[model samples]
Target: MFSILIAGRLPQINFQQVSETQFVIPISDIDHVNHLVVFMTGQIPFPENYGGGGNWPSAEGPSWIFLGKITNVKPSAIFKIGKIKDIESKIGSSLAPTLFSGFQHQTAIPTDGLLGISVEPLSQLDQQIQPHDITPSTVASNVEFVSKMLNNFVNYVTSFVQNVPGTSEQIVPLSIIQTWYNNFQRRITENPNFWR
Candidate 1:
């Protein structure tokens, strides 16, 4: 993760491997604004070539939990804003001065002063990941992709694995692996511990 000092006042944060882009810093440095601090990091996976069936988006960035004065509060533990004490402004341009002057609407917000459910820009979170760049999504995506490819190549390496005539092995695609996992889950739930 990298932290860039913007105008020598605002610290734009970035995360590695889908972590928080910005940190709370405890606001200990600012004698004027002192509040509990926190950090967040997250990223949007590439919609295509990301995972099987492409569950996530292609964009990448860090998560946030900005600390600001509770300008307004609502029934659903919502806080308006006072001043951005940190860069955890998961708020997008669709709202506020960039778009409108209303509280952002989202499903989840960190208690450390996150405003809404929306996430922040990719640059502020981690330097390695950008809107279109892909460093690494889940530690499993790489393992899965490479292993699957290798398995395919290996199948082509040996003939019949011992001269078993008329018999051969076929490589399975990642999508098929996904389907297998889902089916296995269903079977497991039907018995939980069958035969054992």
Candidate 2:
């Protein structure tokens, strides 16, 4: 069961080409958008400054919508992997892919891309999402935030393992690690308190 984080109808949107590879569009929304990028590419739409110089759309300003559409369909693992690759290529980030249960076992040490196992559910917004721009600094911060969340999840599992009987001197089994990771991932997705 996958739910798109962003989905909805965008009203009064206008697209303009700014360069060979970039575009600018104005949107109407009443909030600050987060984590929304061009579908499939994870390309953050640059927020056009109007009336003020905020990086995101405020209740009083115009939200800039970009080309490309996010969909409601659940993305297959391969599709998600491709999207991640696209993002890494565009940002020059080296990302590795990881999968948990209910899928093929693929493992690679993360170097630049996202820790795929911890990826949140992605989807198109049914309504226009709040306008926001993606910046290198914010991307770095998001990575750091994910790392912190994973660390917290690890600590949570460690505490649980410590309570297991007669397991103090034994190696933590891979199955147990995977199970805990899945639980952590689910919790984070269901409740994105980490974003706050």
Candidate 3:
């Protein structure tokens, strides 16, 4: 089974099941949203011949784009929804007719301001490299650089006083801050989902 969790303005959350591998959540429900998360809950794995991915609306031809696959190793995915106007401007042209002809008759495509999400069995997912796609090494290097910068910031802050002001002893000690950062770094290294 698959489920979708949508979070909008602070403290507002919506959940829905993708019954039969398809579901629609009205745009109003997620207006001014913070994040969109999707995951699979079933014990059975996807078939060898089938893979799962999401479909997002395109501005041109009112078509849709495949937003890549969500696999068993990474069952859950999070997305930050961009503004409609920005998305329309960035998404250049509509998809080829051959790719979307089969979906022309589907009722899932929203007419009003509703957002439609679906999981389908796709054999291939446009394997050709796109200029926008980033490599795994690039991501790793970026993460490493950020981690180093954060560590430097923490060390600089800790070096200042090493104790709370106007006190004989160290209140809110430096060790605690260091320990917290170490634990956070370890958790992120082990599994990036700790915050999730």
Candidate 4:
């Protein structure tokens, strides 16, 4: 079983069967601005080698944008849904009823605004490789670059602040900011959940 918790509202909960791997969520009532947290209930594990993936289909339909994936290592994921462009188009019309018939009884899938989430086997996802698919090396390089850039930026800003005349240390203390940057960089290095 899987459940979706839409945060920042009345805490709506939507449930879906594991068999119905693909489904759509309606965002019209919430103004299409919220975070969706999808997670497994652990009542049933995914069949041997299966994994779950998510996608945001284009408002016009046909094209689906890859969001991210959920696996045993990372069972839950948070999706930030922002204001979608051209939301006046009819929703679910182009999408098959099987994609969202599961949720029809609880929350009616909006005809004009909907977000699609798909959970499929890892093998199926491998067949359709996305350009932005993440890799371990890519993540490491990004973190290294970010850490170096932050350090350089902090040094530059600190130097500029010190050189300024009549600038009170109380306004912006170099030590505090530098310490904070150092701590943040350390935390990110040690734990990937710092961003969360």
The CA lDDT at 109 in model 3 is 31
How far off is residue 26 in model 3, in Å?
Answer: 4.0
Which is the leading candidate under lDDT? 4
lDDT of 2 by residue, 1-196 (tens): 1112223653212333333332333332323333333322223322232111111211112322111232323222211122322333432221111112222122232222111111222322222221122222367767877788778767766765534566556345677778877876675444434344
State the displacement of the C-alpha of residue 187, model 3, in Å, after optimal TM-score superposition: 41
Report lDDT (Cα) of residue 29, candidate 3.
42
Q: Estimate each model's TM-score.
A: 0.18, 0.28, 0.45, 0.46
The C-alpha local distance difference test score for the whole of candidate 1 amounts to 0.28
* Candidate order, TM-score descending: 4, 3, 2, 1
After superposition of all CA atoms, the RMSD between model 4 and the true structure is: 12.0
- Candidate 4, residues 62-138: lDDT per residue as tens digits? 56545556666577777554422322232222321122222233334444445555666777655543222222236
Q: Give each prediction's root-mean-square deviation over alpha carbons.
A: 18.5, 17.9, 13.3, 12.0
lDDT by residue (tens digit), candidate 1, 3-24: 2232235543532222222112
**Best-performing candidate as measured by TM-score:** 4
Kindly give the stretch of ten consecutive residues in candidate 4 with the minimal lDDT sum: 95-104
lDDT of each: 0.28, 0.32, 0.48, 0.52
Q: Which regions in candidate 4 have their CA more than 4 angstroms from the true location?
A: 10-20, 30-34, 83-108, 126-196
Pick out the ten consecutive residues of candidate 2 with the lowest summed lDDT: 50-59
- Residue 9, model 1: lDDT of 58
